[model samples]
Target: MEGILIFAPFFLIPYIMAHIFNRVNYSNRWMTYIFSGIVNLAYSVLFDFISSYLKEDKSQPVCHFPLFLFPIFFSPFLILLQFMFNKAIIKSVKYKRNDSQNEQ
Candidate 1:
């Protein structure tokens, strides 16, 4: 669990942000979700690479999975996060547009 802690913020923060945007009925929520996933993937890849390079001369391992394998583990949850956020955004937008149309 401690090991997970290091990567937790990278995933958790974006997940939380996506929920916040969904609540606010932000336009382009799908785009935001996609962008966040891309950013998270990039962050995981970059961090693994850098940490692997640093570990070469040390006795510590930054991750249990191989360098390329880290993204595989990170991807599913990130994609799920995107899907949920995108759904919320779609519903919120639809609701707001309907509300406005009714008002008019």
Candidate 2:
């Protein structure tokens, strides 16, 4: 019960952080990818880091720095991966729109 409560929002990180600044249908897509990745990495890791510090019992049976380090170093890659997925979704939608236009 408690476990689910703690972990559920982790699943929605992308949708929450990824959509805020994305330039859907923008021309310069590389910037979109780079900025989106940067924001997601910063948003996720920074939020977790700050929240951990805010907790009453900061020690949760582990060394916090190492845990923080993992996300700090790894989040960029994950964010970029998320960006790619977003781009793919956008591309598919654009394709569908074009198909519908052609049919009309």
Each prediction's whole-model lDDT (CA): 0.61, 0.51
Candidate 1 clashes between residue pairs 3 or more apart in a chain or in different chains: none
Candidate 2: pairs in clash: none
Q: List candidate 1 segments past 4 Å from native.
A: 19-27, 56-65, 85-91, 94-104
Tell me each candidate's TM-score.
Answer: 0.52, 0.42
Q: Per-residue CA lDDT of candidate 1, range 31-91, in tens?
A: 6656666666666667676767756566754554664565567667767766765565445
Candidate RMSDs in order:
5.4, 6.8
Off by over 4 Å in 2: 1-26, 58-64, 71-80, 92-104
Q: How much is the lDDT of residue 31 in candidate 2?
A: 54
